[model samples]
Target: MSEWRGVAQGCAVIVGVLLAGLAGAGIWIAVYMQGDPQPDVAKAARSHTARAADLLVTAHVDQQLAQLRTALPWATHLGTTVADICETYPANTGFTRRTWTPVMCTRTGTAYLAFDGDFREHLAQLDTALAAEGWKPTNNAGDQPGLVADLDYTHRPPGDATAAELAEAAARPNVATVRYTLPIPSTFAVPPGAGGGPFPIGTVEVAQAPHLPTIDDGTAAHDLTLETRHFVDWQPYSHTQLSTAYPAHGAILAISVRLPYNT
Candidate 1:
């Protein structure tokens, strides 16, 4: 009888083990059927999140484009007006091919303006104009709304300085100065405010040869031809291409030449 009881107990133990195995199998099957067989819940969530973010960005971009379209006409008109007033070409004789748009200049273009003065006077005047106009210098991309000014100027020190010395001077910390060159509309001439000439019309750009790498050759062979242009489109006047090498950091020096009072 003891032997028979022991056999029965053994049988019961085997049955319990089998039942537990079956139960576990069933649970696993149920989980499998529920979904996510591969079980990459985190990845799926990330994909969905990425799609949603894309949609949001697309919507906002469309809205911004719409806004820009609405304001386009006024902006164009302003540009035309400025270009007309500050005709890129110097009003006075002797300036060739408009505001030194290109990097290199012929000997005549780069030559000193009379024995009495250099380019600093124009820079100072431009700086004054920018301040009066309430424009600030900047170096942002063109797509964004702002002005892009390209400026370059070089100072010839007393006596001959070695290339190393010149390079040092070029790299020295810049003393920020306001510089502007602009075309004043015909409307702003002949009053208490507008008397002498074309009132400053565009942004000001005051920078050295290295500062305007686009224009600066680093050769120091030629006289410094301060060549900078204001992208007076819709954007505020600023340094637009400091990041690019071919375009160079200070290629387009910026200045905010203010509009003279309209008579």
Candidate 2:
């Protein structure tokens, strides 16, 4: 009986030790979580940067296009010509000189002008203009000369707040602040051997947002954004036939100033 009693006491001690250890672990976890909370800076900055990039690109394109148009008025309307021919046989056409005669030739055309100018100089001017507007240029190594820029911006709430309050404020859509830097471009020149010509250009591209939120913000906002990057890419020197469907040049303009409220 004494042995059985000792065994029972040992089991009770083991159970007590386990319960105490579990309680201590729980307390440590709670303290750690409270001390090191997840940050909202990355999330807020991403949201703000995306919207700001869209707005800035739109404004930049509009201003640049206006400037280009004013400088080169002839670029507005270009013209192209097409020819049609009709053939007829003469009455005395027996293996003779007048066997076949040209009856009529018709020509049709349109006033759609192709882009022309000193493209390299124009690109330089655009780069200068973008620099004056607070955009920093990025260096890219390739055959074609290109212009890329980055802009950084930040925002904060109007009033003072504690860390906890600031964190909570960040959670609030209206109170939270954001900061980010995004790379953009003003113009791009298609590389040689692209088949379009020696100076094909890609101005702008508009498409849906490249990134979507993983978590729902309850706003159901679905909108598009512009991808100024890859406005032009290099084509290798080869004798391969060029695709006929590709555009020789492009000058698309898209602008959006509204901030992403629920992104």
RMSD of each: 23.3, 30.5
lDDT (Cα, 0-100) at 84 in candidate 2: 17
What 10-residue stretch in candidate 1 is worst by lDDT?
105-114
- How high is the CA lDDT of each candidate model? 0.31, 0.30
Task: Please give the TM-score that candidate 2 achieves against the real structure.
Answer: 0.27
Clashing residue pair totals per candidate (backbone < 3 A): 31, 6
lDDT of 1 by residue, 41-76 (tens): 223223544334324433332332233324322111
- Flag regions of model 2 displaced more than 4 Å: 34-121, 131-136, 142-250, 253-263
Q: What TM-score, computed on C-alpha atoms, does each candidate reach?
A: 0.22, 0.27
TM-score of model 1 relative to the true fold?
0.22
The alpha-carbon lDDT assigned to residue 180 of candidate 1 equals: 26
Q: Candidate 1's error at 44, in angstroms?
A: 64
